[model samples]
Target: MTQELSPCIRTVNVMRYVTPLREGGSMPAIVEADDDFMYVVKFRGAGQGIKALIAELIGGEIARALGLKIPEIVFANLDASLGRTEPDEEIQDLLKASVGLNLAVHYLSRAITYDPTVTTIEPLLASKVVWLDCLLTNVDRTARNTNMLMWNKELWLIDHGACLYFHHNWTNWEEQSKRPFVQVKDHVLLPQASELAAVDALFKPILTEERIRAIVGLVPSEWLTFNVENETAEERREVYIQFLLTRIANSAIFLNEAQHARQSLI
Candidate 1:
């Protein structure tokens, strides 16, 4: 499939702290920005920390590269004094901890959560979503928690912090890249993803090494502070790019795994 070049992620300054979204463990909140727009901001201080933000940035951009609909992601700046007026101790602590930079997505007002039982996705689209989650090894997109929303009659992917799970440990990343996504069986869209082979062939070439590098480059150096291997921010970026390139080369491994899983479901 032909695709356009992905643009750099925009930066926005947080102006107001709206209500907190309690759905996910991260405690992402609805906040107004200086741009006069609302965003669902994911703080760096949450339990999962910056690694989750990195995954959110990388995975969401990868999906965008594949022409998937996703909300606009931005780097939000939070002032140190912003949390001082908060009455709730929990939110106060969270804001105090996330005082510098955070990740946020443009709020999709009036969007409804995607319900598989009530709405059906076509085979090609379903296959693409499944293929994406598999490639990212994303563990969050299951029937129990479909990280999708229906806005303006279009499907928008969201909450990809659970993706790229290998980074949490950062061991044998190359080996992990070639492993099969056994979780495919639980993917909410797997039953309709009948075109895995076709999707695999069409999608593999789209994630070129240079394109992958560009996506990984979006990560800021500040968030790469956690050193598991005494590696610099640039080194960490290379690791992510290499992992994805290796995974794309070994697409057949996971594709076969997904196809087999689909057989059992059908």
Candidate 2:
């Protein structure tokens, strides 16, 4: 039960909407912030809504906690009037809807999508990535959509809004926490990830409860109102914490699932 320092993400004001990535349903866009840096902003008004933002923040931080490479995440402030002059009606509508705080990651220029066919990842690193996705129950890291970028010859994880699927249906979170991530079979790196057990041992202690609680604490209070009846920010945060802690404790389940999946690939 060691305590690690909790990392705090900075808040930035969106100065200009640069362009839309338009890759996912969320319509994440590249925008210029007050700091004069570019970020890929995930709009709260997008189809996935704030839960996606929460997943991005928590999941990205967790990846960073495990010593993985992830772009810096920031709280991007969007003014209500920022989109008034935009010519496109749809972009204008999205901007107007997301006129408060949004989640954004620093824009990595010239980074190419990870092509597993061309570049190879070391076994331990591949195992670590697979392990992280399993812990978060992320379903988007398959071969069809790797959700990884190769920047300066290093792999960077991104787009974790699809993680933490249990939050989408809160009725069975406790049960879901202990379940193995069966989707590991589709994971892009599973075949290369031969060191899951070693990675499990090395990473488990690094993500102490204190660190996890701190990571969950990053979710803004506004995003937790998805369930107006019972899920307050405090309660929702607790759910994330408990789910992750339980999943981490039951890591053997997913580790075995991933190992079996790899064996099938052989």
Q: Which ten residues in a row have the lowest lDDT in candidate 2?
A: 1-10
What are the per-residue Cα lDDT tens digits for candidate 1 across 82-177? 899999999999999998889999999999999999999999999999999999999999889999999999999999999999987787898899
Clashing pairs in 2: none
TM-score of 1: 0.97
* lDDT, candidates in the order shown: 0.92, 0.92
lDDT of 1: 0.92
Candidate 2's TM-score reads 0.97
Candidate 1, run of 10 with poorest lDDT: 1-10
Error of 1 at 105 (Å): 0.4
Residues 1-266, candidate 2: write the lDDT tens digits: 22246888999999999999887779999999999999999999998999899999999999999989999999999999899989989999999999999999999999999998999999999999999999999999988899999999999999999999998898899999999999999999998999999999999999889999989998888888754585577987898999999999999999899899899998
